[model samples]
Target: MEETILVLDKIKKSFDGVSVLNGIDLEAKRGEFITLLGSSGCGKTTTLRIIAGLESPDSGRVLLSGADVTDTEPNHRNVNTVFQNYALFPHMNVETNIAYSLKLKKKKAPEIKKTVAEALALVQLEGYGKRMPSELSGGQRQRVAIARAVVNEPEVLLLDEPLGALDLKLRRQMQLELKRLQQTLGITFIYITHDQEEALNMSDRIAVMRGGVFEQLGSPAEIYELPRTAYVASFVGSANILTGRCAGGGDTVAVDFPGGTGSALRRDWQGREGDSVTLAVRSENVQLLSSDDSRGIPAAVTETRFAGGMLRISSKLEDGTEVVISRYGIGTDLVSGDAIRIDWAAENAVIVLPDSEVAHE
Candidate 1:
């Protein structure tokens, strides 16, 4: 059985009379890497702070390894945080920075030295202990910060966009590094980030937060392939959302869109005929067919752009509904203003709630 390492029960908070976290409940398994993903002011950072005991919740309980730590002070809790700025001391060398926590505990000099060396090795910076912060690159500085946090051997590591300052390539590299470190060290990590790709690539499970609450929570594949709401589908990746109405029923559902009527495999959706529904198809899932193709809906290509590994084609249906499709390659024979047809398989079309329903739910 997987052990529950952390639990947040009905965590709620308010600041200046405005509710921020509205009853957030979550459980993280031992050694799991969980990400709280959302835009700014989504309460992801607030939730992390609450867990770290940096801020007390207005009403809730935080349990770490089954011990209630909601009222505990930040330093008393068995957790460490890695900030986005890599908060290293300019005057201290890497070795001294990593050993600061141990020194504060009055640990012996030899013991602190040994532990710092081990921590440095864990982050692959074994021989750079004597280097000053200014001498290290951004990625190296981040590693030192991780070394410092892990040196304390906390039960949970809370990372607040630690890679936010790095360039895109370095950020990608650190994402993989953090994932590997979590696995190798077998530590529970509660990562906070607004970057969807980082959460998708690194987390064992993701909690999509919005308006101070979790909109959806699940594995990356689950959230990507079967989003529970339109917000999630649109937030996680590129989706071509289309408004439609249910036209047929049974094993499959026929939906009438602005472009045309299409069928989709119905999977326990309890919608009826003439009911408003939305269809979400990933841009990559849409196939561009020839203008003469009888099975496709007629559309006029409005624009095309080469986006490195893929070609993005934008089109407008007869009813003026815009649809975008992505094809893997450098270029497409079709160009702007050309009459084309677009179609997708029934399995690729997902019936979603209308935007209004999504908002209220």
Candidate 2:
């Protein structure tokens, strides 16, 4: 088992008399990559700040490598942060920027030069050390920032949406680079980002935050395949949330949605008959058939569009609930106002408990 390197015990914080981080706990394993994923105002940044010693929690202790660092100064903690902005000193060239931390520690000049060279090489910026920040591209600047942070050899690295400033293509490219850097360094990375794709692509585990608390915390696959709440189902990916009630229960539960009935695999919850439930099915899981086919719920194709090599079909149920289905390949013969039937395998649909039901349990 991996050793626990960082622990946040019941950490709570607030600003301006408004609660930001409602008591939350997280355990990060050594050399693990964990992401705090949520939208703005979700307290992800506040959590990162607390861990970095940039902000103190109103209550709870922060333990780093089994040592209580709740009151430790930012510079005293063995952690480093890279922000959305590169935060590189414009006046300093790449090598100088990366060597600044080593210089502060009063390392021998020879050691600092060697370490800075290694850091630059790790970031694939070997000969660019002499180049100023202004001369580099956005991606190169971000790489330089990462090199600077990793030069400290901190136990844990905190990244706050480091790719947010880059364009889409660059952002995707940096995601791969960041993951490679983390695995190569064998350093624990506590990253923060609101992009779902970024979180899913990069994190070993994700803590989905909302209203200052975790909506769900698990592996990317677990969070995507087995979302615990409707919000998670919707936020993590493209899920069609269908309102329904448990018509019957067993290995498979029958749910009656508006104008149709569907079956979903039974999960951890032992729901009773007639209990209100929500069904979450991914767009890819939904299949569209001709309306003449009687095997599924009837819907009308509201819109169809081609994007990212996938054909996205939007339809509305008889009761006016919008359902979206996605299929690979560009262009579909189906057009707007065409009649269609939507269906999915029983195992593909997930039954989600209502928020109140989940909260009461």
Candidate 3:
């Protein structure tokens, strides 16, 4: 069995009577990479701060390896945080900055030197120790901050959107690097980010927050394929949610949508006859075909966008419901006003409900 390294139990917090985290519960195993994903002001950062002991919850407990650390001071807790702003000492060189934490602990010169050298190499900045923060690029500075945080060998690392400052290309590269470092160091990472792609790419599990609580918690694949609510289906990825009514119940259930009717493989649905429901499908899961194919819902391509490897096609049905479809490669060139049809497999259809119904379930 995997060891549970961290646990947050019914954590509740409020600022001036305004609740930030309302009864948040989460657990993480050793060396697991967990991401707290949500939009701005959704309490993801507040949750991270609470875990790091930088902010205390108004109620509930924070446990590290079965011991309550809710009342522990920030420095006393077995956790460290890497902020988004790469908090580094402007006056100190890389070596000095990395060694500052160890030296403050009153370690001997030799021990500090050895540990700092290892930390530098861990982040692949072995020879850049003498460079000042201002002299380094944005990515390099971020690495230095990571080295400083990890040098002390904290059991859990809390990252608050640490890659937010870097450019798109550098941010993607650093995401991989951070995942590698977490694996290599065997430290549990509690990362906070609003970027859905980052969470999907790096985390073993994701806790999607909304309105001060976790809307859904699961593996990236599970969350994307089986979203519990319309919010989750729309937030985590590009999903086209269609209002529908349940037709019948079986291994494959029938759903009637405004544009068309379809069948979905039952996963987490409990709808009865005549009950209004919602069906969600990812844009990538939707298949676009020529109108003459004589299958699927008829739609007219309203927009064609070239997005790198995939072409995004926006189409509208006779009911005027717009749906987006992603086509890979350049097999068929499409333009606005082109006639097309879209369809998906039964298994690809996921039943997502309103937020309130999903929350109770």
Candidate 4:
């Protein structure tokens, strides 16, 4: 087995008696791009700060390249962060900013220049070395920040929403650039972002955080398909959840929902006959037909929204249960007041726990 480049063992943190992180255990392999994905105030930034030595964890250990660095100062640890605000020295030029850390290390002038040059080239900012921070674009400033961190050649790179400041197009471009950089450099990257698309696009593995704990961790496809928790399913993407009771089948379970509609079992949840369960289906997995009684019970159309090449048809069950269906090839006939049916395969559904997150009460 490959040794983990970074590990957080039994980490905890709290502020003003409100817990932000509750015993988080995570590991990062060498050169792996791991994104800490969650909404605002989910303790993602706090976790990054603790790992960087900027904040103290109540009780935990921070390891780097198999060395215990929990007590090491931010500068002493082999890690650096690129914050969202681009914390660049206002008075320094690009070259000076990149070489600032090397100067602090007391490296020779020639060595510092060479390292700075190499870092700038790595970030595709070779010719902009003499430009001031104020004169560069938001993306350029971010690249400079990245260059400064890479100039040190740290074992880990901590990015706290570094590309959040850029507009949509540039952010997408930078996402690609960052992925390429990680592949070329082979340094462990701990990126934090609230954008689901970015996390799904860039991460080798994602730690979905909510209520101060990791909800799920896996590859993008695995996390999307096999979300072990309800919060993870709803947070990562759009899901149409329906509540029902479990009924026994020969080898598989059957869920009989309200309005006499039954859906094939989505999971092997431990439940007795008549026990309540929530059945989840992704919008994309749902099948929509033009007429009522196509598959199961009739659904009353409530709203319709166009999403580029696809149409989102919203409907309510006979018991007023809301369900969303995503289908392709939009048509003018997709409007409210149309009665339809919702069809989905058994493999497309999942049974999830009602509890939000383990960290929550």
Q: What residue pairs clash in candidate 3, if any at all?
A: none
Kindly list the per-residue Cα lDDT of model 1 for residues 129-189, writing each as its tens digit: 9999999999999999999999999989999989988999999988988999999989999
Model 4: worst 10 consecutive residues (lDDT sum) = 258-267
lDDT of 3 by residue, 53-124 (tens): 989999999999999999999988889888888889999999999998798789999999999999999999
Note the Cα lDDT for every prediction shown: 0.88, 0.90, 0.88, 0.85
Off by over 4 Å in 4: 264-268, 289-294, 332-334, 356-359
Q: Where in model 2 is the C-alpha error above 4 Å? A: 329-335, 355-361
Worst 10 residues of 1 by lDDT: 352-361
Cα lDDT of model 2 by residue, 1-361, tens digit: 2999999998989899999988889999988999999889999999999999999999999999999999999999999989778789998999999999999999999999999999989989889989999999989999999999999999999999999889999899889988999999999999999999999999999999988888889999999999988778888977998877789969988887665678899877677899877888999999888888867788999899988778999999887889999999886888889988888898999877546654311
For residue 1, give model 2's deviation from the true position in Å: 6.1
Best by lDDT: 2
TM-score of each prediction:
0.92, 0.93, 0.91, 0.94
Model 2 lDDT, residue 262, Cα: 80
In order of listing, the candidates' clash counts read 0, 0, 0, 0
Task: Give the residue spans of candidate 1 off by over 4 A.
Answer: 318-320, 359-361
Instruction: Report the error of model 4 at residue 41, Å.
Output: 0.9
Candidate 4 lDDT by residue in tens digits, 9-74? 989999999999988899999899999999999999999999999998999899988899999999
lDDT of 3: 0.88
| Model 4 TM-score relative to the real fold | 0.94
